[model samples]
Target: MLHLLTPDEIFPSLPEVDLERLQRRGVRGLVLDLDNTLVAYGGREAAEPVLVWLREARAAGMRLCILSNGRPRRVRLTAERLGLPWVESYTKPRRRGFRAAARLLGTRPHETAVLGDQIFTDVLGGHRAGFVTVLVNPVSRRELPHTRVVRAIERLVFALLLRRGRIDREAWRLRTS
Candidate 1:
């Protein structure tokens, strides 16, 4: 169970992710979380840097999809603004959404990477679905009530991992150049 929640990589932000490195590893697709992962919670649009990265990633021949648990309208609107496909109101920590995102990207699980801010939902779901997982710090501390509760648990888990030296806090905090 703990292993399922463990992310394969941790980064300070989405922009820090090395798309070229992922490509070298044969990751041809990306399944991204919408809210804190790409922008602040309740944000209706992607930030300029995110848009630039998305353009670059697409140009590099990577398929992308927004897989989010947000309301359908919000998700769809955001996706349209970013000019990307999306699966809204997706129930994470469940394999179905991850699988569906993979299908939408036209990539098998092994050839895809799931990037998000939540460990329990994004990491667990992606791991369970056999996709690589990248966990990024949330863009904002504000989140939904239920997500706040999960964040508490996530902190505890992160503390334990830190104590065991399984993760490097400073390394994960390094800002992208």
Candidate 2:
């Protein structure tokens, strides 16, 4: 049960993800979380570095899809700017949305990776769907009130996981390259 919340990999930020390493590990597709993942909370567009990372992934022949819980118009606009397909208002932590994103990417769960900032949502849903899960630090300190509450719980769990050695420090290092 606790393992479901554990991410397969962790990166300081989205741009820090090593595309080459993911490719070597058989991740041919990516299902991305929008808010505080690709874009900062309440931001209109992805930063230049994020854009570059997406471009690099595309150039490497990786399929990408945005699965956002945000409003339809916001999600659609962001997806359009990113030039990626999207599943809007996709309540995360649900297997349905994750699987839908996988189908949209035309990739099997094993071939897909999900990247996001929240453990309870993105990591849990990705694990439930049998896709590789990557967690990144939230791009902004600002977030919704409900999310702030969840973030507190996330911190506790993360510490416990670290103390118990459930997190693989070596795998964390492996991603740096």
Best lDDT among the predictions, by candidate number: 2
The C-alpha TM-scores of every prediction are 0.92, 0.93
Question: After aligning candidate 2 to the native by TM-score, how far in Å is the CA of 154 from where it should be?
Answer: 0.3
Tell me the tens digit of each residue's lDDT in model 2 across 1-177. Answer: 889987888888999998888888899999999999999998988999999999999999999999988888999998998899999745688889888898899999999999999989999999999999998988888999999999889877776676678786654343322
Q: After superposition, how far is residue 138 of candidate 1 from its true place, in Å?
A: 0.8
| Stretches of model 1 off by over 4 angstroms after superposition | 169-177
Q: Give the per-residue lDDT digits (tens) of candidate 1, residues 63-156.
A: 9999998889889988988888998646787989999999899999999999999988889889999999988888888899999998888888
Model 2's C-alpha root-mean-square deviation from the true structure amounts to 2.8
Q: All models: lDDT?
A: 0.86, 0.88
TM-score of 2: 0.93
Q: Candidate 2, overall lDDT? A: 0.88
Runs off by more than 4 Å, candidate 2 = 168-177
